[model samples]
Target: MTTMFRKALNALPRLGVQVVDLGPGAAVISRRGRYSATKVSADAWMVGGGRRSTRAPAEGWGLRKAAASSLCARHVADFLANYEVNCVFDVGANRGQYGRQLRESGYRGRIVSFEPVPDALARLRKAAERDPDWWVRPVALGRSESVQSMHLGWKTMNSLLEPSAYGQQRYKRFADTRTTQVQVRRLDKVMDEALHGIANPRPFLKMDTQGFDMEVFAGAGERLDEYVGMQSEVAALQLYEGSPHMTEALAAYEEAGFGITGLYPVTREETTGRVVEFDCVLARVSSVPGSAAGVRP
Candidate 1:
Protein backbone atom coordinates (compact mmCIF):
# COMPACT_ATOMS: atom_id res chain seq x y z
CA MET A 1 0.00 0.00 0.00
CA THR A 2 1.11 3.55 -0.75
CA THR A 3 1.90 6.08 1.96
CA MET A 4 -1.06 8.29 1.09
CA PHE A 5 -3.47 5.32 1.21
CA ARG A 6 -2.11 4.31 4.58
CA LYS A 7 -2.60 7.80 5.94
CA ALA A 8 -6.16 7.87 4.64
CA LEU A 9 -6.82 4.52 6.21
CA ASN A 10 -5.73 5.90 9.57
CA ALA A 11 -8.76 8.18 9.37
CA LEU A 12 -11.07 5.19 9.07
CA PRO A 13 -12.48 5.37 12.60
CA ARG A 14 -13.72 8.85 11.75
CA LEU A 15 -15.71 7.36 8.91
CA GLY A 16 -17.81 5.31 11.35
CA VAL A 17 -15.89 2.08 10.96
CA GLN A 18 -15.27 0.19 14.17
CA VAL A 19 -11.57 -0.31 13.68
CA VAL A 20 -9.78 -2.32 16.39
CA ASP A 21 -6.10 -2.60 17.04
CA LEU A 22 -4.35 -5.95 16.72
CA GLY A 23 -1.33 -4.47 18.51
CA PRO A 24 0.12 -1.11 19.36
CA GLY A 25 -0.70 1.32 16.54
CA ALA A 26 -1.96 -1.49 14.29
CA ALA A 27 -5.58 -1.52 13.15
CA VAL A 28 -8.03 -3.38 10.98
CA ILE A 29 -9.21 -0.25 9.16
CA SER A 30 -10.44 -1.90 6.00
CA ARG A 31 -14.05 -2.97 5.62
CA ARG A 32 -14.27 -3.16 1.86
CA GLY A 33 -11.54 -5.74 1.31
CA ARG A 34 -10.63 -6.63 4.88
CA TYR A 35 -7.13 -5.43 4.15
CA SER A 36 -5.75 -5.36 7.70
CA ALA A 37 -3.15 -2.66 8.37
CA THR A 38 -0.34 -1.77 10.74
CA LYS A 39 -0.82 1.95 11.33
CA VAL A 40 2.06 3.14 13.52
CA SER A 41 4.00 5.61 11.41
CA ALA A 42 1.40 8.37 11.30
CA ASP A 43 -0.59 10.07 14.04
CA ALA A 44 -4.22 8.98 13.75
CA TRP A 45 -5.46 11.82 15.96
CA MET A 46 -3.97 14.41 13.66
CA VAL A 47 -5.32 12.75 10.52
CA GLY A 48 -8.78 12.47 12.03
CA GLY A 49 -8.92 16.10 13.13
CA GLY A 50 -7.86 17.48 9.74
CA ARG A 51 -8.73 14.88 7.10
CA ARG A 52 -11.48 12.49 8.24
CA SER A 53 -14.89 14.04 7.79
CA THR A 54 -17.22 14.45 10.76
CA ARG A 55 -20.21 14.65 8.34
CA ALA A 56 -20.68 10.87 8.61
CA PRO A 57 -21.41 10.05 12.24
CA ALA A 58 -23.09 12.70 14.34
CA GLU A 59 -22.12 10.96 17.55
CA GLY A 60 -18.62 10.26 16.25
CA TRP A 61 -18.79 7.24 18.55
CA GLY A 62 -16.59 4.99 16.50
CA LEU A 63 -14.10 7.72 15.75
CA ARG A 64 -13.79 8.80 19.39
CA LYS A 65 -13.47 5.30 20.82
CA ALA A 66 -11.24 3.66 18.24
CA ALA A 67 -8.94 6.66 18.03
CA ALA A 68 -8.49 6.55 21.82
CA SER A 69 -7.63 2.87 21.70
CA SER A 70 -5.11 3.39 18.94
CA LEU A 71 -3.69 6.48 20.62
CA CYS A 72 -3.46 4.75 24.01
CA ALA A 73 -1.56 1.96 22.31
CA ARG A 74 0.74 4.52 20.78
CA HIS A 75 1.18 6.10 24.19
CA VAL A 76 2.39 2.78 25.65
CA ALA A 77 4.82 2.44 22.77
CA ASP A 78 6.08 5.97 23.40
CA PHE A 79 6.24 5.45 27.15
CA LEU A 80 8.67 2.59 26.65
CA ALA A 81 11.04 4.93 24.88
CA ASN A 82 11.41 6.97 28.07
CA TYR A 83 13.78 4.32 29.38
CA GLU A 84 16.87 3.05 27.66
CA VAL A 85 15.49 -0.43 27.22
CA ASN A 86 18.23 -3.04 27.05
CA CYS A 87 15.79 -5.76 26.10
CA VAL A 88 12.07 -6.47 25.96
CA PHE A 89 11.02 -9.81 27.40
CA ASP A 90 8.22 -10.81 25.08
CA VAL A 91 6.77 -13.62 27.19
CA GLY A 92 4.04 -15.67 25.57
CA ALA A 93 5.41 -14.55 22.27
CA ASN A 94 3.41 -16.50 19.76
CA ARG A 95 4.97 -16.19 16.31
CA GLY A 96 6.94 -13.08 17.42
CA GLN A 97 4.04 -10.73 16.75
CA TYR A 98 4.78 -8.43 19.73
CA GLY A 99 8.43 -8.24 18.84
CA ARG A 100 7.58 -7.39 15.24
CA GLN A 101 5.09 -4.78 16.38
CA LEU A 102 7.63 -3.22 18.76
CA ARG A 103 10.15 -2.90 15.95
CA GLU A 104 7.54 -1.35 13.68
CA SER A 105 6.74 1.14 16.45
CA GLY A 106 10.38 2.33 16.17
CA TYR A 107 11.80 0.35 19.08
CA ARG A 108 15.29 -0.57 17.88
CA GLY A 109 16.41 -2.38 21.01
CA ARG A 110 16.94 -6.03 21.68
CA ILE A 111 13.82 -8.25 22.05
CA VAL A 112 14.02 -11.49 24.00
CA SER A 113 10.94 -13.62 23.38
CA PHE A 114 9.89 -16.86 25.12
CA GLU A 115 7.42 -19.33 23.65
CA PRO A 116 6.60 -23.01 24.22
CA VAL A 117 3.69 -23.89 21.95
CA PRO A 118 5.03 -26.37 19.39
CA ASP A 119 3.46 -24.77 16.31
CA ALA A 120 4.11 -21.24 17.52
CA LEU A 121 7.66 -22.12 18.44
CA ALA A 122 8.38 -23.29 14.89
CA ARG A 123 6.97 -20.11 13.39
CA LEU A 124 8.62 -17.89 16.02
CA ARG A 125 12.08 -19.34 15.49
CA LYS A 126 11.85 -18.85 11.73
CA ALA A 127 10.45 -15.34 12.11
CA ALA A 128 13.22 -14.05 14.42
CA GLU A 129 16.09 -15.83 12.63
CA ARG A 130 16.77 -12.76 10.52
CA ASP A 131 16.83 -10.16 13.32
CA PRO A 132 19.94 -10.36 15.45
CA ASP A 133 18.42 -8.37 18.29
CA TRP A 134 15.21 -10.43 18.25
CA TRP A 135 15.89 -13.65 20.15
CA VAL A 136 13.51 -16.57 20.84
CA ARG A 137 13.49 -19.23 23.55
CA PRO A 138 11.54 -22.48 23.44
CA VAL A 139 10.36 -22.34 27.05
CA ALA A 140 7.25 -21.47 29.05
CA LEU A 141 7.28 -19.29 32.19
CA GLY A 142 5.35 -20.19 35.33
CA ARG A 143 5.62 -20.29 39.11
CA SER A 144 7.99 -23.26 39.00
CA GLU A 145 10.47 -25.05 36.82
CA SER A 146 8.81 -28.23 35.62
CA VAL A 147 6.60 -29.68 32.94
CA GLN A 148 3.01 -28.45 32.72
CA SER A 149 0.19 -29.05 30.29
CA MET A 150 -0.60 -26.07 28.06
CA HIS A 151 -4.18 -25.76 26.90
CA LEU A 152 -4.10 -25.11 23.18
CA GLY A 153 -6.30 -22.49 21.67
CA TRP A 154 -6.88 -22.09 17.96
CA LYS A 155 -4.84 -18.90 17.93
CA THR A 156 -3.07 -16.68 20.46
CA MET A 157 -5.33 -17.65 23.36
CA ASN A 158 -3.45 -20.68 24.61
CA SER A 159 -2.61 -20.86 28.33
CA LEU A 160 -1.14 -23.06 31.07
CA LEU A 161 -4.45 -22.99 32.96
CA GLU A 162 -7.75 -24.40 31.80
CA PRO A 163 -10.29 -21.90 30.57
CA SER A 164 -13.29 -21.11 32.75
CA ALA A 165 -16.86 -21.54 31.52
CA TYR A 166 -17.32 -17.77 31.46
CA GLY A 167 -14.38 -17.42 29.07
CA GLN A 168 -15.75 -20.22 26.92
CA GLN A 169 -19.15 -18.60 26.87
CA ARG A 170 -17.70 -15.37 25.59
CA TYR A 171 -15.36 -17.08 23.16
CA LYS A 172 -15.36 -20.75 22.23
CA ARG A 173 -12.17 -20.79 20.24
CA PHE A 174 -10.37 -21.70 23.45
CA ALA A 175 -13.12 -23.88 24.88
CA ASP A 176 -12.66 -27.60 25.29
CA THR A 177 -9.08 -27.09 24.23
CA ARG A 178 -6.49 -29.76 23.70
CA THR A 179 -3.56 -29.97 26.08
CA THR A 180 0.12 -30.60 25.41
CA GLN A 181 2.91 -30.86 27.93
CA VAL A 182 5.70 -28.25 27.72
CA GLN A 183 8.84 -27.45 29.67
CA VAL A 184 8.39 -24.58 32.11
CA ARG A 185 10.87 -22.46 34.05
CA ARG A 186 10.98 -19.55 36.44
CA LEU A 187 11.84 -16.09 35.07
CA ASP A 188 14.45 -15.36 37.75
CA LYS A 189 16.49 -18.41 36.76
CA VAL A 190 15.97 -17.91 33.04
CA MET A 191 16.85 -14.22 33.05
CA ASP A 192 20.04 -14.81 34.97
CA GLU A 193 21.11 -17.43 32.45
CA ALA A 194 19.82 -15.51 29.43
CA LEU A 195 21.48 -12.19 30.20
CA HIS A 196 24.59 -13.26 32.03
CA GLY A 197 27.45 -10.71 31.94
CA ILE A 198 25.19 -8.23 30.12
CA ALA A 199 25.89 -5.36 32.51
CA ASN A 200 23.07 -3.01 33.57
CA PRO A 201 20.44 -4.51 31.28
CA ARG A 202 17.32 -2.45 31.79
CA PRO A 203 14.71 -4.90 30.57
CA PHE A 204 11.06 -4.25 29.86
CA LEU A 205 8.78 -7.23 30.55
CA LYS A 206 5.53 -7.76 28.63
CA MET A 207 3.28 -10.75 29.13
CA ASP A 208 0.38 -12.02 27.03
CA THR A 209 0.20 -15.46 28.59
CA GLN A 210 -3.58 -15.71 28.38
CA GLY A 211 -4.46 -15.98 32.13
CA PHE A 212 -1.12 -16.81 33.66
CA ASP A 213 0.06 -13.21 33.96
CA MET A 214 0.18 -13.18 37.75
CA GLU A 215 1.97 -16.51 37.98
CA VAL A 216 4.47 -15.25 35.47
CA PHE A 217 5.07 -12.33 37.82
CA ALA A 218 5.17 -14.57 40.85
CA GLY A 219 8.13 -16.34 39.28
CA ALA A 220 9.85 -13.05 38.46
CA GLY A 221 9.54 -11.28 41.82
CA GLU A 222 13.26 -11.47 42.50
CA ARG A 223 13.95 -9.53 39.31
CA LEU A 224 10.82 -7.39 39.32
CA ASP A 225 12.72 -4.41 40.62
CA GLU A 226 15.20 -4.68 37.78
CA TYR A 227 12.78 -4.07 34.95
CA VAL A 228 12.11 -0.51 33.77
CA GLY A 229 8.51 -1.14 32.88
CA MET A 230 6.07 -4.05 32.90
CA GLN A 231 2.86 -4.71 31.04
CA SER A 232 0.37 -7.55 31.50
CA GLU A 233 -2.96 -8.56 30.05
CA VAL A 234 -5.55 -8.50 32.86
CA ALA A 235 -8.96 -10.12 32.84
CA ALA A 236 -12.10 -8.63 34.42
CA LEU A 237 -13.48 -12.03 35.36
CA GLN A 238 -11.90 -15.35 36.22
CA LEU A 239 -10.92 -16.71 32.86
CA TYR A 240 -8.59 -19.30 34.28
CA GLU A 241 -8.12 -21.19 37.51
CA GLY A 242 -6.70 -18.99 40.33
CA SER A 243 -5.43 -16.32 37.94
CA PRO A 244 -5.45 -12.71 39.10
CA HIS A 245 -8.30 -10.63 37.80
CA MET A 246 -8.53 -6.82 37.49
CA THR A 247 -8.57 -5.79 41.15
CA GLU A 248 -6.18 -8.48 42.35
CA ALA A 249 -3.80 -7.91 39.47
CA LEU A 250 -3.66 -4.21 40.27
CA ALA A 251 -2.89 -4.90 43.92
CA ALA A 252 -0.26 -7.44 42.98
CA TYR A 253 1.51 -4.94 40.77
CA GLU A 254 1.28 -2.31 43.47
CA GLU A 255 2.96 -4.64 45.92
CA ALA A 256 5.61 -5.39 43.31
CA GLY A 257 6.81 -1.76 43.25
CA PHE A 258 4.94 -0.85 40.07
CA GLY A 259 2.17 1.66 39.53
CA ILE A 260 -0.76 1.25 37.16
CA THR A 261 -0.33 4.13 34.77
CA GLY A 262 -2.02 2.92 31.62
CA LEU A 263 -4.94 0.67 30.79
CA TYR A 264 -5.78 -0.17 27.17
CA PRO A 265 -8.77 -2.33 26.47
CA VAL A 266 -7.69 -5.48 24.67
CA THR A 267 -10.99 -7.34 24.40
CA ARG A 268 -14.62 -6.50 25.08
CA GLU A 269 -17.96 -8.30 24.96
CA GLU A 270 -20.37 -6.62 22.59
CA THR A 271 -23.53 -8.17 24.05
CA THR A 272 -23.28 -7.20 27.72
CA GLY A 273 -20.55 -4.54 27.52
CA ARG A 274 -18.09 -6.55 29.58
CA VAL A 275 -14.39 -6.01 29.23
CA VAL A 276 -12.78 -9.41 28.71
CA GLU A 277 -9.22 -8.23 29.10
CA PHE A 278 -6.92 -5.22 28.93
CA ASP A 279 -3.25 -4.40 28.58
CA CYS A 280 -2.13 -2.73 31.81
CA VAL A 281 1.13 -0.78 31.69
CA LEU A 282 2.92 -0.32 34.98
CA ALA A 283 5.96 1.75 35.81
CA ARG A 284 7.99 1.52 39.00
CA VAL A 285 6.53 3.86 41.63
CA SER A 286 9.92 4.78 43.04
CA SER A 287 11.56 4.82 39.62
CA VAL A 288 9.59 7.87 38.56
CA PRO A 289 8.39 9.38 41.77
CA GLY A 290 6.01 12.39 41.53
CA SER A 291 5.56 11.79 37.78
CA ALA A 292 2.13 11.02 36.35
CA ALA A 293 3.32 7.55 35.46
CA GLY A 294 4.11 6.62 39.02
CA VAL A 295 1.52 4.71 40.97
CA ARG A 296 0.19 7.06 43.65
CA PRO A 297 0.21 5.83 47.23
Candidate 2:
Protein backbone atom coordinates (compact mmCIF):
# COMPACT_ATOMS: atom_id res chain seq x y z
CA MET A 1 0.00 0.00 0.00
CA THR A 2 2.84 2.41 0.81
CA THR A 3 4.64 1.62 -2.43
CA MET A 4 1.48 2.07 -4.46
CA PHE A 5 0.70 5.42 -2.80
CA ARG A 6 4.31 6.62 -3.04
CA LYS A 7 4.44 5.83 -6.73
CA ALA A 8 1.16 7.68 -7.31
CA LEU A 9 2.27 10.65 -5.21
CA ASN A 10 5.51 10.80 -7.27
CA ALA A 11 3.50 12.24 -10.18
CA LEU A 12 1.56 14.83 -8.13
CA PRO A 13 4.44 17.33 -7.68
CA ARG A 14 2.34 20.05 -9.31
CA LEU A 15 0.01 19.67 -6.33
CA GLY A 16 1.20 20.76 -2.87
CA VAL A 17 0.61 17.29 -1.44
CA GLN A 18 2.25 16.89 1.95
CA VAL A 19 1.71 13.48 3.51
CA VAL A 20 2.57 12.54 7.07
CA ASP A 21 2.62 8.97 8.34
CA LEU A 22 0.16 9.10 11.22
CA GLY A 23 0.12 5.43 12.25
CA PRO A 24 0.60 1.86 11.07
CA GLY A 25 -0.88 1.54 7.58
CA ALA A 26 -2.33 5.06 7.95
CA ALA A 27 -1.19 8.33 6.41
CA VAL A 28 -2.63 11.86 6.40
CA ILE A 29 -2.48 13.81 3.16
CA SER A 30 -3.11 17.53 3.05
CA ARG A 31 -2.30 20.62 1.04
CA ARG A 32 -0.66 22.02 4.18
CA GLY A 33 -2.75 20.45 6.99
CA ARG A 34 -5.18 23.42 7.18
CA TYR A 35 -7.90 20.79 7.35
CA SER A 36 -7.72 17.72 9.59
CA ALA A 37 -7.42 14.13 8.33
CA THR A 38 -10.40 12.72 10.15
CA LYS A 39 -11.42 10.70 7.07
CA VAL A 40 -8.52 11.09 4.70
CA SER A 41 -8.35 8.86 1.65
CA ALA A 42 -5.06 8.00 0.00
CA ASP A 43 -6.94 7.28 -3.20
CA ALA A 44 -8.30 10.83 -3.35
CA TRP A 45 -5.41 12.13 -5.42
CA MET A 46 -4.90 15.79 -6.50
CA VAL A 47 -7.93 16.50 -8.63
CA GLY A 48 -7.11 19.90 -10.26
CA GLY A 49 -4.95 20.73 -7.20
CA GLY A 50 -8.03 21.07 -4.98
CA ARG A 51 -9.24 19.07 -1.92
CA ARG A 52 -12.84 18.58 -0.87
CA SER A 53 -14.89 15.74 0.56
CA THR A 54 -13.93 14.08 -2.73
CA ARG A 55 -10.27 14.94 -2.11
CA ALA A 56 -10.01 16.80 1.25
CA PRO A 57 -12.51 18.51 3.52
CA ALA A 58 -13.53 21.94 2.25
CA GLU A 59 -15.36 23.03 5.42
CA GLY A 60 -16.22 22.06 9.02
CA TRP A 61 -16.07 18.79 10.97
CA GLY A 62 -19.23 16.85 10.31
CA LEU A 63 -20.71 13.34 10.46
CA ARG A 64 -19.17 12.60 7.03
CA LYS A 65 -15.70 13.26 8.46
CA ALA A 66 -14.80 9.89 10.04
CA ALA A 67 -15.97 6.61 11.46
CA ALA A 68 -18.86 6.63 13.98
CA SER A 69 -17.40 8.26 17.08
CA SER A 70 -20.47 7.83 19.29
CA LEU A 71 -21.53 5.40 22.02
CA CYS A 72 -25.12 6.13 23.05
CA ALA A 73 -24.72 4.88 26.63
CA ARG A 74 -28.08 5.67 28.15
CA HIS A 75 -26.93 4.95 31.70
CA VAL A 76 -23.88 7.19 31.53
CA ALA A 77 -25.83 9.91 29.78
CA ASP A 78 -28.41 9.86 32.56
CA PHE A 79 -25.74 9.93 35.25
CA LEU A 80 -23.77 12.77 33.67
CA ALA A 81 -26.98 14.71 33.16
CA ASN A 82 -28.15 14.19 36.73
CA TYR A 83 -24.79 14.94 38.32
CA GLU A 84 -24.43 18.43 36.81
CA VAL A 85 -20.90 17.45 35.94
CA ASN A 86 -19.08 20.43 34.47
CA CYS A 87 -15.59 19.01 34.30
CA VAL A 88 -14.74 15.57 32.89
CA PHE A 89 -11.34 14.04 33.49
CA ASP A 90 -10.83 11.39 30.85
CA VAL A 91 -7.95 9.34 32.25
CA GLY A 92 -6.08 6.86 30.03
CA ALA A 93 -7.64 8.33 26.96
CA ASN A 94 -6.04 6.36 24.13
CA ARG A 95 -7.61 8.37 21.25
CA GLY A 96 -10.37 10.56 22.66
CA GLN A 97 -12.85 7.67 22.33
CA TYR A 98 -14.91 8.51 25.42
CA GLY A 99 -14.69 12.26 24.87
CA ARG A 100 -16.05 11.81 21.38
CA GLN A 101 -18.86 9.69 22.76
CA LEU A 102 -19.72 12.33 25.35
CA ARG A 103 -19.88 14.98 22.65
CA GLU A 104 -22.16 12.80 20.56
CA SER A 105 -24.38 12.26 23.57
CA GLY A 106 -24.95 16.08 23.66
CA TYR A 107 -22.38 16.81 26.37
CA ARG A 108 -20.99 20.30 25.79
CA GLY A 109 -18.75 20.92 28.78
CA ARG A 110 -15.09 20.89 29.67
CA ILE A 111 -13.48 17.56 28.68
CA VAL A 112 -9.87 17.15 29.74
CA SER A 113 -8.26 14.04 28.28
CA PHE A 114 -5.00 12.39 29.38
CA GLU A 115 -2.99 10.14 27.06
CA PRO A 116 0.58 8.83 27.39
CA VAL A 117 1.13 6.87 24.20
CA PRO A 118 2.76 9.00 21.49
CA ASP A 119 0.97 7.58 18.48
CA ALA A 120 -2.33 7.56 20.34
CA LEU A 121 -1.74 11.12 21.57
CA ALA A 122 -1.38 12.38 18.02
CA ARG A 123 -4.71 10.84 17.13
CA LEU A 124 -6.29 12.21 20.29
CA ARG A 125 -5.01 15.71 19.55
CA LYS A 126 -6.42 15.52 16.05
CA ALA A 127 -9.81 14.49 17.40
CA ALA A 128 -9.77 17.28 20.01
CA GLU A 129 -8.60 19.94 17.56
CA ARG A 130 -12.04 21.18 16.59
CA ASP A 131 -13.46 21.32 20.09
CA PRO A 132 -12.46 24.50 21.92
CA ASP A 133 -13.40 23.19 25.39
CA TRP A 134 -11.72 19.81 24.96
CA TRP A 135 -8.12 19.82 26.14
CA VAL A 136 -5.56 17.03 25.68
CA ARG A 137 -2.79 16.41 28.21
CA PRO A 138 0.00 14.20 26.88
CA VAL A 139 0.71 12.38 30.14
CA ALA A 140 -0.27 9.45 32.33
CA LEU A 141 -1.76 9.39 35.83
CA GLY A 142 -0.43 7.25 38.68
CA ARG A 143 -0.02 7.33 42.46
CA SER A 144 3.11 9.45 42.08
CA GLU A 145 4.66 12.06 39.83
CA SER A 146 7.53 10.48 37.87
CA VAL A 147 8.41 8.53 34.77
CA GLN A 148 7.21 4.93 34.49
CA SER A 149 7.61 2.21 31.91
CA MET A 150 4.13 1.62 30.53
CA HIS A 151 3.31 -1.67 28.87
CA LEU A 152 2.04 -1.18 25.36
CA GLY A 153 -0.81 -3.33 24.11
CA TRP A 154 -3.05 -2.85 21.06
CA LYS A 155 -3.58 0.74 22.25
CA THR A 156 -6.54 -0.36 24.38
CA MET A 157 -4.89 -2.80 26.83
CA ASN A 158 -1.78 -0.67 27.36
CA SER A 159 -1.01 -0.04 31.04
CA LEU A 160 1.65 0.73 33.64
CA LEU A 161 1.55 -2.93 34.77
CA GLU A 162 2.68 -6.04 32.91
CA PRO A 163 0.01 -8.38 31.61
CA SER A 164 -0.58 -11.28 33.95
CA ALA A 165 -1.28 -14.89 33.03
CA TYR A 166 -4.98 -14.43 33.78
CA GLY A 167 -5.14 -11.84 31.00
CA GLN A 168 -3.17 -13.82 28.40
CA GLN A 169 -5.41 -16.84 28.83
CA ARG A 170 -8.44 -14.72 28.13
CA TYR A 171 -6.92 -12.92 25.14
CA LYS A 172 -3.41 -13.37 23.77
CA ARG A 173 -4.00 -10.19 21.77
CA PHE A 174 -3.83 -8.12 25.00
CA ALA A 175 -0.28 -9.19 25.83
CA ASP A 176 2.28 -6.45 26.38
CA THR A 177 3.74 -5.87 22.93
CA ARG A 178 6.22 -3.12 23.93
CA THR A 179 7.23 -0.71 26.68
CA THR A 180 7.50 3.07 26.74
CA GLN A 181 8.84 5.48 29.32
CA VAL A 182 6.05 8.00 29.93
CA GLN A 183 5.68 10.94 32.29
CA VAL A 184 3.21 10.33 35.10
CA ARG A 185 1.52 12.95 37.28
CA ARG A 186 -0.92 12.86 40.13
CA LEU A 187 -4.48 13.74 39.12
CA ASP A 188 -4.86 16.16 42.01
CA LYS A 189 -1.72 18.00 40.92
CA VAL A 190 -2.79 18.05 37.30
CA MET A 191 -6.15 19.50 38.21
CA ASP A 192 -4.48 22.25 40.17
CA GLU A 193 -2.44 23.24 37.15
CA ALA A 194 -5.18 22.73 34.55
CA LEU A 195 -8.20 24.08 36.36
CA HIS A 196 -6.40 26.85 38.28
CA GLY A 197 -8.82 26.57 41.20
CA ILE A 198 -12.04 27.03 39.28
CA ALA A 199 -14.91 27.26 41.77
CA ASN A 200 -17.51 24.52 41.88
CA PRO A 201 -15.72 22.17 39.48
CA ARG A 202 -18.30 19.40 39.80
CA PRO A 203 -15.80 16.98 38.30
CA PHE A 204 -16.56 13.53 36.91
CA LEU A 205 -13.75 11.08 36.37
CA LYS A 206 -13.88 8.40 33.66
CA MET A 207 -10.95 6.03 34.16
CA ASP A 208 -10.02 3.20 31.79
CA THR A 209 -6.50 2.43 32.92
CA GLN A 210 -6.47 -1.30 32.09
CA GLY A 211 -5.67 -2.95 35.47
CA PHE A 212 -4.28 0.15 37.17
CA ASP A 213 -7.58 1.85 37.91
CA MET A 214 -7.09 2.05 41.68
CA GLU A 215 -3.56 3.34 41.29
CA VAL A 216 -4.88 6.08 39.06
CA PHE A 217 -7.62 6.84 41.58
CA ALA A 218 -4.98 7.14 44.29
CA GLY A 219 -3.43 9.92 42.24
CA ALA A 220 -6.65 11.89 42.71
CA GLY A 221 -5.94 12.16 46.45
CA GLU A 222 -8.32 14.37 48.46
CA ARG A 223 -9.57 15.92 45.23
CA LEU A 224 -11.96 13.00 45.07
CA ASP A 225 -14.16 15.21 47.21
CA GLU A 226 -14.81 17.38 44.14
CA TYR A 227 -16.25 14.59 42.02
CA VAL A 228 -19.97 13.88 41.70
CA GLY A 229 -19.63 10.54 39.92
CA MET A 230 -17.07 8.21 38.35
CA GLN A 231 -16.82 5.23 36.02
CA SER A 232 -13.86 2.86 35.85
CA GLU A 233 -12.98 -0.27 33.91
CA VAL A 234 -12.43 -2.93 36.55
CA ALA A 235 -10.75 -6.29 36.03
CA ALA A 236 -12.59 -9.33 37.32
CA LEU A 237 -9.54 -11.58 36.89
CA GLN A 238 -5.96 -10.81 37.84
CA LEU A 239 -5.04 -9.24 34.53
CA TYR A 240 -2.02 -7.47 36.01
CA GLU A 241 0.25 -8.16 38.98
CA GLY A 242 -1.22 -6.83 42.26
CA SER A 243 -4.49 -6.10 40.50
CA PRO A 244 -7.38 -5.89 42.94
CA HIS A 245 -10.29 -8.27 42.60
CA MET A 246 -13.53 -6.69 41.31
CA THR A 247 -15.27 -7.27 44.64
CA GLU A 248 -12.42 -5.61 46.51
CA ALA A 249 -12.64 -2.53 44.30
CA LEU A 250 -16.39 -2.30 44.89
CA ALA A 251 -15.89 -2.61 48.62
CA ALA A 252 -13.17 0.02 48.66
CA TYR A 253 -15.29 2.46 46.67
CA GLU A 254 -18.20 1.86 48.97
CA GLU A 255 -16.00 2.62 51.98
CA ALA A 256 -14.86 5.81 50.26
CA GLY A 257 -18.44 7.16 50.16
CA PHE A 258 -19.47 5.86 46.75
CA GLY A 259 -21.88 3.15 45.58
CA ILE A 260 -22.14 0.88 42.57
CA THR A 261 -24.79 2.25 40.25
CA GLY A 262 -24.24 0.09 37.18
CA LEU A 263 -21.94 -2.54 35.69
CA TYR A 264 -21.26 -2.74 31.96
CA PRO A 265 -19.57 -5.92 30.69
CA VAL A 266 -16.36 -5.29 28.75
CA THR A 267 -14.78 -8.70 28.23
CA ARG A 268 -15.45 -12.36 29.00
CA GLU A 269 -13.63 -15.68 28.91
CA GLU A 270 -14.77 -17.09 25.58
CA THR A 271 -14.54 -20.70 26.72
CA THR A 272 -16.02 -20.63 30.24
CA GLY A 273 -18.40 -17.70 29.68
CA ARG A 274 -17.16 -15.84 32.76
CA VAL A 275 -16.89 -12.07 32.45
CA VAL A 276 -13.24 -11.07 32.91
CA GLU A 277 -13.72 -7.32 32.80
CA PHE A 278 -16.49 -4.78 33.26
CA ASP A 279 -16.95 -1.05 33.75
CA CYS A 280 -18.19 -0.04 37.19
CA VAL A 281 -20.33 3.09 37.21
CA LEU A 282 -20.37 4.79 40.60
CA ALA A 283 -22.14 7.73 42.21
CA ARG A 284 -21.79 9.49 45.55
CA VAL A 285 -23.62 7.83 48.45
CA SER A 286 -25.21 11.20 49.28
CA SER A 287 -26.20 13.80 46.71
CA VAL A 288 -24.74 17.32 46.91
CA PRO A 289 -25.17 18.92 43.46
CA GLY A 290 -27.78 18.78 40.69
CA SER A 291 -29.80 16.97 37.99
CA ALA A 292 -29.62 17.57 34.19
CA ALA A 293 -27.56 20.71 34.57
CA GLY A 294 -24.57 20.81 32.23
CA VAL A 295 -25.75 18.66 29.32
CA ARG A 296 -27.64 19.58 26.20
CA PRO A 297 -31.03 18.03 25.67
Task: Give per-model TM-scores.
Answer: 0.76, 0.71
Question: What are the runs in model 1 whose C-alpha is more than 4 Å off?
Answer: 1-42, 45-69, 289-297
Candidate 2 — which pairs collide?
52-56
List model 2 lDDT by residue over 1-297, tens digit each: 457766655655467776654445455566653444333233331121234554234433332222111121556776887777778899988988888888887888789999999989999999999998899999999899999998876657788887777767766776538888999999989887666555657778888888778888888888886677888887777888888888888887787778888886666554465767778889884654433432322
The residue-level lDDT of candidate 2 at 61 comes to 30
For 23-130, candidate 1 gives per-residue lDDT tens digits of 444555544332223333364432232234445341243343465466656766786777666688899999988887788788887788999999999999988999
Which 10 consecutive positions of candidate 1 have the poorest summed lDDT?
Answer: 45-54
How far in Å is the alpha carbon of 35 misplaced in model 1?
13
**Positional deviation of 50 in candidate 1, in angstroms?**
22
List per-candidate RMSD values in Å: 8.1, 13.2
The CA lDDT of each predicted structure is 0.75, 0.74
